[model samples]
Target: MTELDSTAFELLGSTGPFAELVSGFNVREPQLRMAAAVEQAIDAREQLVVEAGTGTGKTYAYLVPVLHSGKRAILSTGTRHLQDQLFHSDLPRVCEALGVQPKLALLKGRSNYLCLHRLQLTLEEGRFARRRQAAEVQAINDWSGRTRTGDVSELSDVPEDAPVWPRVTSTADNCLGSDCPSYRDCFVLKARRRAQEAEVVVVNHHLLSADMALKEEGFGELLPGAEVVVIDEAHQLPETAAQFFGLSLGSRQLQQLARDAKAEHLREAGDMQNLPDSADALDKAAADLRLAFGQGNRRLPWKDIRHKPEVESALADLRSVLEQLRTWLETAAPRGKGLEGCWHRAEQLAHKLARVCAEADGEYVQWLETYTRSFAIHLTPLNVAGIFQQQLARLPATWVFTSATLAVGQDFHHFTGQLGLHEPHTLQLESPFDFQSNSLLYVPPALPEPNSPSYTGAVMDHAEHLIEASGGRAFLLFTSHRALQAAADRLQESEYPVLVQGQMPKRELLRRFRELGNAVLLGTSSFWEGVDVRGEALSLVLIDKLPFAAPGDPVVQARIDRLREAGGNPFMEFQVPGAVITLKQGVGRLIRDAADRGVLVLCDPRLLNKPYGRVFRRSLPPMPLTRELREVEAFFAAGMTDKGEQARA
Candidate 1:
């Protein structure tokens, strides 16, 4: 400890190893402070939460300390992209800079790995709906022979969402584990083994939450031995925890179970025609249940349609088919490990279906979601705090949660209360970049309320003016797909290239947006966060309205009702704070680096018309605010002048 403490000052100093090796690295006071705080928390084995604002170099801030400490730690990030960045990029750089060789491993969800058993089954079937899918499966088969890790991401030629993936990947229900021929070659198991032995393991929030919520019982020992857990993007943990802690019975799960059962029955129990018949019945029943929801997609409280004749009949049919399958599967359980696995999965699914379809439990909010071709019934717990706290108790380790937007106006209550963090240390580090000078917040005047029918038109009118000023390097983010579509429709004849979300894959869309350099992207909620376009690729950001969770959403409505029933103000306490964090994420896209400069145009008039707007005002970065059109144009003009001056220098 003494040796490391003496070297800490020189390690991240202006001319230190990090500055020498890493590109564009700067000595930040906040980064150093955060590192010290993380070190202290790791040493004392305490829980800590930090709201490290953007540009704090938070990745290196915690990485340096954890690498120096050499503890058995788990680093969970927000998404797969971040997981890859941390493990494949940041971790290696930090390890090299510190001259350490601590063993490291990256683990993703089971679905991300190629299942050799499933691949063989798919090959034996030798059938694909489309010629392209047939080619994709052959490509995967060729790659599977040589790939070491068996991670599907290794084959870049094939798209991630290709239908061939589901055919080749093993789900918990379908995996034969040690009883299968490919058990020794199972990529999921091998990854887990590597994670179990590594000093540091990198994972995503969804996978980490699955383990914490006990969703994957007895699956692996990934989290049990960790001395410290660093959760980046902690702001997303509560929602992810809620999802994992809940129970869900979806059409896809049922359909997969049916498909696998039929396939296995053909090979293992060919003499038993009853097994295949039952599998087909179950599959048809699941699709019928989806059909009961009709064509339009929506989410509603289960009670809303529980008594509908069509839906009720479909539900009954599904349960009957599921029970019949279980009965037949019981008879054929001794056929093989595959049959035995199907029987177990049917039992579990039946139990989940019974629980989900039954009367609502007060602890969980029962809801049903109908997609275009599928439906899912969920029992999301009203609160994940207790469930989360229990898991944290079981794993008594130093826990740290950090994100750029965890706090609302310097208050962490909204985040802390969600996960039941007890007396945990909290730190808020403002971004080191000069936001006040580098960015301007523009709220065009005379706009109608967001709920008004003419709102999209009014917002786009100002969006165009701002886009012209900034030369169309812009992201016009909306709260709803309808609004984004409406805006996209209006900009068809515009001079600048317009890229709309859903026109292509998100990664490819972002790639083209960057390459075009002056393109306008119109996107909905997913675009608000996790999409980073730094430098001149993106300079102006226009958010259509305050990103309030849809009040009509079943889960959101249930939470609001629950809170209100308990004599709490759900609007101010929950919705506003959540929206503030979301808006902060949108605002964050403008200025990613110290040299980055841009304009943020917030079109929501509620920001100024309503009194609650003050909370949002204080929560945003300390940027220059404006409601005048001339000022926005002037800000961009001055930005152009700065660029010209830099170019001359």
Candidate 2:
């Protein structure tokens, strides 16, 4: 490997190569320092964790080193938006600046690509029951005919959650693979092949987790040949990894399996008796299982549901139906390859469901979640750190995990411990922006505690004054949907436009918030992070409470129970640091750019009364902290006055 000189690192800093390549580029010390750290980690083949504050240009910082190193690397991001941005915009710009041409491929999960076989089957069967569904199918068909990539995102007219999408896309359980007539033109296969041959592959966290677990479609792997893996938005990795390592079986999956089995049997099983009846029976059993859950959407532990006679009976009947279906499929196995695949899927599903239902060992937590029309059973491990550590140990490569919020109060223990990375190289680079001058952390005095009955009203009253001060250019973030709605209702009387989260989609709401320029958006956890709006349009961020995961959540409860059993302090070890990271994300949403300035309102009184509150205060950016309402008003007033003076001058 050729050693890159200091000048190469300098090129990434201010007044270097970026000044010539990027428009409106400013030299940032933190960005340069991060780039150097990444380059060193890559060169030395070391594990690195970095918490680069927002505006550090960490994307290009890591991209420059990874691309310039001439090593095949897997770049995994937390969202498809960032994946697309890196592949289409950031990677290309950095490669151009470095004067290097590397083969790059963007790969998403199988669901994002159109399956020609599924599309043809849906079209041939005329499965569209609604006019809107038919229109969406037609739109997808039209796009498929003209498109090369077969990416669903290319169809701008099609909403992502369209009901017709599931009918036209392939899942691992349903895909016929090389046995299908459309195998040669499979978009998913083509994308994976390209990714395999590329020097750099861009994927999301879910896809990376799927790869790590060897659960990728067609039993393929993407990480074997890569020399380095860079996981962006690393704070989300532990949760995503947990999901990948867990076992999940849903009613919808069973229904789909039954449908596919019956269809395949009909086409290939030459007069096989009782096959269709068995499939119908399996479908009925799935419906019965869903009904056994009673009403409403909820999650219940196995201990609570197993003792119920009705649930037990329903489970036994479901198991019997699955066994019968599996027997029929096995007896008719000589039909064709497609029928054989269906039989294998049914067998696997039956065994998995049986294991999940029967196993209540201490290592795993078994729970059931019921939706309005369907339900799911899951077996999630109490801890995934050990499993993830094993996976990392098996892969011989440099691992880099980075995010804007990964540390709490200069400590990386919570983040590192969750991933089981002991003694990895760590760096924390604060945002170079002048937070002291550009922001104010306002905690109003005399507010009730977060758990108090009057806390919602108190939060709304204070948020109303702050929103009025900033003229509705604010994001009123809440810790729960209930609080968000209450705030929305109380603020409805205001003259400015108010946009709540559930009224429309998040992207649309953000768009409207930006265009209105002075609209107040009320949202819960989703709005706290991965949202950016610059200039005077978003000058205030109001958080209702510290974002602690609800103790009622089954996963959270299970983890807490496990920690307590192990004689560990769950509250201090898990809850506090997690809330601190979340609060930091909420605050980070305010000052996205160097010139942006804003006021942050944290309405939770515990920040002052509780001793642990110091962790949250210390973790946040070093913005000017204040406890008075007039100080907030005066800050905005002075900003307006300065704008007026600049206009006149």
Candidate 3:
């Protein structure tokens, strides 16, 4: 292996651009270990797993090596927000510091950039909502005038979830290359070309998985040529990988395609009016799916429903129609330059639908997931371990997975095993923060069981007290959206300002919460991790329950049954570890800096009633523990008083 430069390390430790960039940040032993691991992974061409705690500067640690290494690499994150941050802010700062002018390109899943041809067609066709069309046209007009990279994220007004954007954007499944007249100015193709020539590329895990899954569909593959692939937010890998390997069809996607076809005049092909009938067919397919499932509310195993022949037949028919449609679209694509782009998009969508339909097997669980205004038919694999192993083994490039919550109770077994990672080098680096003085863990006593009728109310009572103590700076984390909404409603009239998740976009809500300073935020799932609220603004984190996957969930149930046949206790083998890692993530949200201090209030009485609670607590930072609500309040009040005195002095 190539040796790390000792003098360079010492110089970085002493003075230089590295010192300037990281001067405000504290580098501990774990961060150094992370830096070393990154270097070794690049040098030796081997897999490495380093789970660094929160506030560990994992981004810089990995970027340092990329700057120093002479080889090419691709860094894939889990979120578009992070992808934008790295490409726009993080990478530039690091590159400047190291004085390394490496060509870098940011490639998101193709859906993020504007497809000029599609946008122009949609606008001219008068297909979209008037206001939406006007706004998108204006944004794209401005985007086209200034965008060198063509990423639509440059428009601040456009939410990532906007329907108008997708209509104007291109996915791998829908992009036309050289055959399209707009190929010379295709944004996605332009970005991919830039990536092909660059030494370093930044991508999200979703796009990375898509590249891996659809290698033949794109330019070889996204990261296949790179020497090293570093995955940040690594705890999310298993779930993200499962999504790529599985299948899903949303009602919105089907409906949109039908609408777009009619608007774009593509439905004018042979026996034209027959196209709208296809929409009717899709509606019937949807109705049949819903009826077969019958008021689908709970997540259940596939075996439980496989006995119903009607349900199975409906699924088979849906898949068959999708396959036929795709085949028809592929063959009908016109050769005319102007019309060829539209033809290619139709074919690509067909192919993607067909690919997903093929993967929706009986081994995978299917469920109807309802949102407030939308719904989707989701198919998730019973166990992604085997699937990930199959995929990863094909690639020769080195992989490094790093996250603060990769290990449970200091054991990497649960995480690694879930990813089918065996005998890969594993290291659990301890937290750099001085937790003894920096934080406290408070498990409120006399709480109702999670299964009890009064569980939500009881948890909120404790949360109310914590918010009062912290002067309303707290994140009330729940295991379900129902529970989170309930708490938000209850706290709406409280003295402290309350910010709920669904009230606005996540980024907007977070912005409002930060601006409010002493506000109470209630959220589920997404907020449990990947949130960085430091110091006094966020002092208390209240967890409503242990975040175990719902036992009734089809995917969870199937995995549990799979393990049972293999002579394993499902609760201990699967449930406990998963919940432990999740709970740790929720707790780790507090104390992001050396001066930061806070209390973690776990409202789940099961931590006391159940035998597995110790595992969860042990995985968290070593902080003073108390079950008394009074003691928790006192600690927060003390921190507040000290802060006030410091400000006055």
Candidate 4:
């Protein structure tokens, strides 16, 4: 091996810095292999995709290589939370262990940093939806006086989801750029400067995609000199890329514009009631459009409802008022920076609304999603391969995309194809944990087809048995909210503590579950991935069915139609591969640590009955598979016995 390769192996070896400095460290062959692959890719300036399974320590694998290379690198994670953790927690430890002080910076989107201009506007207005919001604003004002970073995350007094955040934080659409009165003290610009100067930069996928979008989010700054780009949790990029590449106009944006217009009107031209009047008119039109959407949250093709009289009328009225608002803002644009920003936002939103409201061009799926009080129209591209590939071509960085769940059945075709990656080197590393001994995959016998009317009841029956076997430390994952709610209601009277999703925010639910120790969490999509609960706190995962993308969803349907037009099997080529990846995520929730033992109960009959199920079966970790409830019972019984013996000893 080369000296550099030997150096990497020795660093993460059994007697390496991590093993000596970091407590509870275990060197794994998979981690070492993955790290070597990353190092080679970085040296060769190659595109590499690695599925370093859970427990493979993929984070340190790539970090050691990047730190060793001493090259400018951009490390992108899945979410802002992960980005923070890597910067504040993981990166520091690794750097300390390696005895290398790399210049690092953490950069998030503009909304994360408090905008002094918006805060000044909000303080002057003193308008709030509730009394609590006023208090939150006051708290923010107090904290703003001393925060060096001006990141809203620094203020713990106000909840992250507080309504006041939107009022204070700037978005790309509303930011006044260099014209703002607070431009000199802009936290976003300061953060970007740090990132631009740093040798190592940590960011989330949203910002990465936004950067790729280039002009859309005002990002394309820090990536110019990046010699290596490591995308941790790379599975999320395709969907995030789709969002960034798409055209969207939301109710929140329009309402925020209306509110900002009113705020700017009072500041700029109080005598001209026309601007405020148009803003109010636009609010009314937006409300009417939302009301016309009629009830439960749904996403459907815009063409499906475009012809309905109420929808058609409400949409036309909304468009008219939005255009009128843009015109009024044009007259008011010379007044102030805020008014000018509002004018630009209005013009952009109006143009986007008109384009998305128009007929599809066969390349995009024109869809509308309605919420309880708001709605959004999106024109998402059927494929993002060309756009993604073009962006990568512009960058001279070596790319590494690693995730616990990227490949399906030992191939990167499903993932690499989505991004038009050309001849990328790929690696599939099985989890280093001894899953064959520590975990069991149990598929209950005689379950009906997932579409059967009695399927949910049957699944709940199986859930009851599994939750009992694992003694309440289980996650009852369902494919739909309907099934989730049904399971929650049924478990209401059970002896075990039942924590349901949407009962509270996701973070709170997880915190409570970890605290409760034996609580059963019934959740849907969000809970399927990125959750880590080791030890006995989480010992069972019961999936109601294989998670398939909703065939009825506008984007899915559009893609299906497109594939059919091209004479491809959408089910095998698209749906099944996607489902396999998702199922891997859910299954991955169990057996997080080597010492941990758990049961994975996939309550779907399709695994055994369908021909394509082999793909999912092959893709999962090599756990002992079973079909009998007795075996599951015995697994837990053995765990209890071992604990008893350990305590006694």
Candidate 5:
């Protein structure tokens, strides 16, 4: 390995050229130390795990090194928001600061790009069922004529979860590849080509996993030639990797195949034969299978599903129709632009169904979820460590995994062990922010336990006091939707504007919260992490409970059982550390910048009562602790007075 050059190392320091080129660049020792570690990892071709706290400027720390290394690298983040920040914002500024321009590409999953063929088909078939749907389709069609990248993100007017998106965008199962009518101008293909040739590629964890698993077509492997792979929000990689490694077959996939088959038949003007009837039968069988789940949405283990006669009958019927459809598609030998894609989808779906129904393996936990209109069979691995280790072995690239929440009390074992990395170089950098004065960890005394019947009301009562003290600039984060709804109900008549999670999209809700400057936003899991709200707009973050996976969840139960069977302490080894990391993420949301000041309210008494409470305390930032609501009110009042003084000055 080549020795690290002083020139590259010097650039990270406060007096370096970076500081001169970038405006308002602060000289943070942690950021410089992290940058050095990243550079060394790349030069030595070894794995590195880093935990850089909230104000460490971890992004620029790693970006400077990766860009300076001049190596083909893949930078994967956990969310598209971060991906965009890196690709569109941070990368450009850092590259300019370094006076080097590297070829860069931002690639997302296939579904993020527009498929011209699918759009044309949707338009030709007049598939819009509502006025809004038609308008959305028309908007996309109009945008398609001018979008240079064809990224769905360009259509900010369209909601991310719009029903028309799936119809207009193509998935792996439905894409026709070179056989596509729009092959010459395919947005996904163009993006892939750019990524294959770029010096740096920015992608989300899911896309990176798909490429690592070789699940995506057209691109045989996404990271083969890259020299360094830096994963931001690396904590999410293990779960995302497990999801990609596992097999899932949803009713929607089957229905989409049937729809595509019918479309192909119509486009080809081919003999219908029994193709249409088979498609109808498959659709009906899928509907029957959904009905067999009875009512409401729930996930159940194979044991529970096996004993239900209705579910069993519906599964048998669905399996029969899928097999019949696959055979018909195979025998028909339909010659058309899209028929082959449909046939391939049918074959793959049939095989997946067979695999999902087979006897569960010891390493995997097989379960099924019944949604309102669709059902899916899932086979999630009990542990992803082994699978991830094998993938690492396959790709001999320098690996760097960094996240703010990867370590608990200065230990990276919980994070590294999940990814099968035994002893990679490890670094823990505390946030440079003066948390001792800027933040307060407030735990009100005499609160009801999280599981108590009166817990929600109690939490609301406390939260209302905190919000009122902070002048309604707070985030009321709940562990469950039930608690969130209950809190929303209790706070409905408050003087402050209440923004619930489902009332609008997450981004919109955040925008409103920031704009209102004194609104309370109630949300669940999605808001726990990857949410960035800085300044006086968010002064208090109230967590109703410790963020622990519900023990009743089939997957969680299976994992606990597996841990027990292996003779490990499930509570200490799995549950406590996991919850600690989650709590850390929730707390990290409050202090984003050096000037940001906020009060974090952890309503869960477990932090003070449980034997493992110390673990949670040690994992959080070193902030002053308080138990008195009056202290919280005093802190806010002091903060307001400070602001007033600054304004007068």
Candidate 6:
């Protein structure tokens, strides 16, 4: 390599496209330090952990170095939205200004693409004809002809929650891979091939997890081996890794098998007498479980049923029925091709059910839940750290994880320990924005305790007060659906327009919220992070609680027990750190740009009552603090006037 290529970053020296990008853009010291550190790390080929604060421009800090290095790299973001932004907006703009010619590809998982073969089968066999209307099929038919990417996102007219997509889509279990007749025109395979040759590939955490799991199964490589992998939103890694590692068998899987069997039986016009009998038995068991769960209104751990005869009886009956169905399917397997396929699917599902029945090992926790109208049995690992460590030990790539909230109070112990990454070179970069002048932390006084009977009402009142103070540009975040609904219902009674979570599709809601520029949105998980609303449009954020995982949650309980076994205090080790990281994400939503002004109202009084409150408080952005409610109103009022004057000028 030439000298220019060897030290191009140094020779370019602080005044190229990157510097120009920040010329009138107000380059803060912390962002520049992060950019330089990223450059050094790229040259050294070492692992690094960076906690880039809100408004740190961390995207550019790493992108500049990655682009300059001119090596094949993979950028894995936490969400599909960020993956889209990086591939379509950030990379193109930066590469154009720097005159870098690096091919890039946006690669999603198999499910995200349209499977033409599956689409043809669904239409030809009339499998989903009953669930979908004629107009919907016509819309999809029109879409299939014009789509190059085959991403469902292209069909903006179709709601994401629509049922039509699932019927025509393919899952890993059913995908025939290269055996399919349309392999030459397969969208997913084509995308993977392009990604293999591209210099930079943008993918989400789920896709990365898929690749990791696939590698373990001795499958062909799903992703190219890159010299470096940059992971954004690193805080979500532990929870997502746990999901990909654990196992679960839902009622939907059983229902899908039955439906598939019916479809096949109809297609071949074969006798499905025994198959329907097994399907009916499975359906009846599912209904009985649902009814029993409804009548009990109890959330019991797997072990708690030892004393309750009724609970034990119900579980025993369910298991017996499932085993009987499995036996019937096995007997019918040798009769015909249609029967064999159904039997195979049933057997695969039954293995998981049998594991649930056996309560296989202490590493797994068994629990039953009834939500909306359906019930499910979940078997989540007590600890994913052991599995994650094993997986990482098997890999040889240089992994670079970056997020705005990985480190808590300038320490990496909270995040790095959970992911089982020890002694990695850690870096903390503060937000580029001047938080002292641009942001205010509001902790309202005279509010009811979080556990008090009237807590939700008090929180709604405080939320209303804060939103009114900020002229209705606010996000009221809650830790529970009950709290979200309470806030939304109360807000709707008032003057401000309320954009609740399910009122509309997320994309359309966000778009309308931004367009309205002065609406209050009430949401839970999805709204806690990855939301960017800059300037005066979003001037307040009200968090209903500390965002601790619910106590009844099986996964949370399992993780807590695991922490205790390690001689660590579960409250301090698991709960406190998790809340702190999530609180950071919620508050981070307020101030997106340097010039933005907002008030972050944390309604939880436990933040002040408990000793661990200090940990949560100190992890927040370094905004000017205020306990007096009037101070918040005055600050936002003045901010509004100043913004108005600037707009007029």
Q: Which candidate should be chosen as best, given TM-score against the real structure?
A: 4
Which residue pairs show collisions in model 6? none
Best by lDDT: 4
Q: For candidate 3, which ten residues in a row score worst on lDDT?
A: 2-11
lDDT of 2 by residue, 368-471 (tens): 89999899988888777898899888887889999999998899999999999979999999999999898999998998778899999988888888988998
Model 5 CA deviation exceeding 4 Å by range: 1-8, 217-219
Task: State model 1's lDDT.
Answer: 0.88
Candidate with the larger TM-score of 4 and 5: 4
lDDT by residue for model 5 (542-647), tens: 9999999889888889999999989999989999889988889888889899999989999889889987899999899998999998999999999999989999
Off by over 4 Å in 3: 1-8, 15-17, 20-25, 129-133, 216-219, 264-271, 276-363, 372-375
Error of 6 at 106 (Å): 2.4
Model 2, CA-based lDDT:
0.87
List ranges where model 1 is wrong by over 4 Å: 1-9, 215-220
Return the candidate ranking by lDDT, descending: 4, 1, 5, 2, 6, 3
What lDDT would each prediction earn against the true structure?
Answer: 0.88, 0.87, 0.74, 0.91, 0.87, 0.74
lDDT of 5: 0.87
lDDT of 3 by residue, 162-271 (tens): 76787777655445567555788887888888889989898888887666655633545555678888888888888888877766766566555555554444533544
lDDT of 5 at 403: 94
* Local lDDT at 629 for model 2: 91
Per model, state how many residue pairs clash. 0, 1, 0, 0, 0, 0
lDDT of 6 by residue, 313-399 (tens): 666666676676667667766654544666667767778777765654878888766655566667766766677767667654566
